[model samples]
Target chain A: MNPRLVFKAALVCLLLVLLAEGVLTLAKRHAPFFRLFQNQIVSCEILDDLAACSLKSGRPLIVVMGDSVVYGSDLHAHGVPHWREQALAAGLQRQLPQATVLDLSLDGALPGDYLGLYAAARRLKPDWIIFEYNYRMFSQKFGSPSEAVSRPWLRGLMSQPLFPALPQTAGDKIKSVLRKVSQLYRYAEAFRDAFFFPSREEVINRLLAQVLPSRSLRDPGDREMLLKLKIKPHYYTPLLTPEHAGLQAVQLLENELRRDQQPHLAFFTPQNQEYITEIADPHTWPRNLAILDSILGSLADQKRFFYWNWGALYPADAFYDHCHLVPRYNETFAKMLAGIIADGGRRDHVQRLE
Target chain B: MFNGWNENIRAFLLGLAFFLLLILILIFGQDLSSSKFIYVDF
Candidate 1:
């Protein structure tokens, strides 16, 4: 055989093998991809889905929607009893003694994200929703709250392609498609993790000893620097907004609740004494107070609404750092919530429907 | 009747064909496993 012919035949064989491999890989993961389908397909959604399914079928949800603080970082990841470490259901059982508490919080969520969730909750008909606004809630500082609307249906309309509020462009369509593809990858990753990888708690435990070394979270200056980088700390990005934007977020959320006639409780999570003192200069603290006051005033007559200012509740030692409540504080916070649910709100309806 | 142009062209084409064939083999041999390692502790 001529050398040329041999080379051509070899090349063709290689091409066939590559094509076959591609086809097989695509076929095997197709279903998983479709199930997950999002940008940078992350396992985050898979976990969210599993939790959502449980909430949907088992009982009325008591969602705790907010940012990373809700995920319980200050609490030791392994099994150390911390804020969210306690099974919310068990705690609710002790308090309400009848209803179940289903925490649907995801770390890194903002007010806008919470609004998205609130809209979903409306459809699900959750009995109670706690809109826990941590320090990051006012980070945006956008002024002038958006007009309140009665229909929760319109919340995501503007952000999604279906709404005319956002301009639909070719680039946007491409981005949307890419996001879907990424989501598929994420689903696959999550599925893979579910089977092969260690649970998040386990992994966090292993790394915690090494990464966090001291019980003390990184030095305050170090954390502040990291926050400025717009990296590890999820709050920094949102905090960059003008002060007014942040306040607007709270106002709009309140207005939204009023329009939907949904019952909600908003709490400003406890920050360590350091963060409080650092921000405590008479000006900033009062400004923050004003924002919270304004939000409460808007709902003044709606006796159903409640607010917990941890600033007055826990001591400085109760914090992991400037912003996060340490684990001990988490237990205290959980107990506080339980007490409030048990005694503060409407007594006749407390677990009455259940 | 000793022209090198034809010989060079033939050699180049042969090499190109071989390269393509090798790629095809790798692609076809790819694993279809949906399972992936999220993090591996060494």
Candidate 2:
């Protein structure tokens, strides 16, 4: 081949890559570009604090933080009433009409993210703080727990426990830089989410379910498939362990809350026990729940914070998956949470008067 | 040698065209009405 031809081919490939990157960046920036096919594109503004978004000055403020569970991934396809934050706010407003609720939860938010959210939220002097506890999130490992501890913002906030520290290598640093610079690298996950998995029918069905009150969000065929599948007994064993980084991260959050003299509520979000029981060994399933409940219960007790282990509150069908509650159940859960918060507030008021 | 070089150049051009076509399909085939925000799971 001629050297000129080789150079031309290389140049074409480079141009194509850059063009693809530009398209992806545009899709990310503008919602209309990605929404035509009924795809739910997630775009969030980067704000320093939750209060920065919008706040009612005189109302008592409540801030809740957690992962996708709290962010309401299952409800995204559904319309307004089904969103967890919206439902919860509506419920809370009914009970405490003057209070404001700020949901700081995002998808894939770990305890580390909560630590940052909490730090920022504290500046706003919220009346109450609620953190959603999902056992599945406990299995996540931090990249550099030691380095996180050393950071000035995280200093005195996060601490390393018995979990192994994953140091940031030179390769990791280079990859991080590349991920930031390369649009394809940055939006790879979004691309997969947009085109892959959850066939078009499934997405349509979810929307239909939201509109039609009688229709189930999950397809009967999908439910039948899930029923036939069995999960490994040891799947949750790593997360059940006491020394996992996730648990330690929660501990760090608890410590910081205590030091700051902040009163908070930590609730164990409902899990699909029926699915767990079917997939996991009978002996191991109960043990796993027991271990997790004990850890969280003990932490709440130690910190004098309100805790509710509502893991088994919902029926098996309420879950679209092993973890996320369907929109209807999410609304019910929010109402229950609002009731609990109201009750806690009343009890505190009575105690203070006494 | 000239014939072999010509074949190689043709093959390279064909491959490059295929690659560009794939990228174009991905860009144009994308659904644009999605209102969902990105959620990160721990």
Candidate 3:
């Protein structure tokens, strides 16, 4: 019960927490322990470096960016025929044999992140840039693009507006301090993810699913399984009004590309219509699509870039979930995209001749 | 008699115990269901 004993105990606890956090950080980077969860954990930095290297290769480079759909989450555990690799194998490379395709997509990436990525990627002078425009990200407001890659504490602090009108209560201020200072508090999500490791059977199933050709087939069971996954309906919320920050970021991205005379394509990626219809209110579904189309259409018209709304292009069977395409459809989607790009290039060439 | 030194020791012990309990809960009692890696919303 001595004060010195109490002080010693507190110091020991702090040191233990710090040591555990350090180990977790190292595991995140080097340890093979986390590789089992690769389906969920994406290394954005590695993807960025790969894209940058591809860009600098002096070949005509095509950079693709977006959220999980573009990250090919639906192709989880499947080793061969990744969307990017299939795009190349599906004659995308052969069509433009001198060009290279680099996918810079990551899970949860937004327009703000895309803006920052474009800024970084443009320096490498890619011939064409394609960004998947998921309507959901456009509806949500975003923090600063530059801070997206900063350290957790700095990112959380810098993401806040410089001059906030509302005064913070003492409790709010205390929580903020804890969030910034406590490694345990800041990396709670990471810890949770690490703790919930998938079983070996599940991991094996995912891997086998990747290799087995029948696994990609459009089964009636897919609908029930997808429904069981609890795909949230909130994503279909009709942004009756546009989010200014998102629009501005998209506008800025378009303006920069046009100024640099770079060819860019913004494609409205497909979503599972069956899932959307089942989950979303009938009125909200069409309204949301219209609102998204209007924004992308206006941007394309204003910036003189190509914007194609392919949201309903693929059937519900083409998707494993509400958003991502099944691995079987990757080649088809790639060929469709290549056709568009190739056709666009021929049209531009003809226009130049005129 | 509970003097100032005794009182300070009691408060310090209570604080230390509380923090240790919290750290233990975080380390062992994490919700396994809360580990979906991708944020579906954004």
Q: Tens-digit lDDT track for model 2 on A11-69? A: 66776678878887665544334434222222221222234433535677887776656
Docking class of 2: incorrect
Chain A: TM-score in each model: 0.59, 0.60, 0.59
Report the C-alpha lDDT of model 3 over A1-354, residue by residue, as the tens digit.
676767766776676677766775555454245434432333333334455556557676887777767666445423344444443233345556667765556555666556656665666577778888775564432323322321122223333332233355564465457654554654553444344332222443556668884873334476356444434444545454543455555666677777878788787788788777766657766776787677777767524377877777777788766677766566566666676676663223211000
TM-score versus the correct structure, for each prediction: 0.55, 0.56, 0.56
Find the 10 residues in a row with the least total lDDT in model 1 chain A: A147-156
Which stretches in model 3 have alpha-carbon errors above 4 Å? A1-56, A77-97, A139-230, A302-304, A345-354, B1-42
Clashing pairs in 3: A78-A210
Model 1's chain B yields a TM-score of: 0.54
- Cα lDDT for residue A195, model 3? 45
Residues A1-354, candidate 1, lDDT per residue (tens digit)? Answer: 577656665665555545645664465344344333211122233325534564656754565665445555334332345344443333444455455565545443446555555554555455667766655444432122332211121232233212235354564455345334443322333343443222333454446658777732244564456444432222332213233444544555667777777767776665555455544344455565565656655654536676655445556666555655555445556666766665544323322110
Top candidate, metric lDDT:
3
Error of 1 at A344 (Å): 6.4
- For each candidate, what's the DockQ? 0.07, 0.15, 0.10
lDDT of candidates 1 onward, in order: 0.47, 0.55, 0.56
Q: What is candidate 1's TM-score against the reference?
A: 0.55
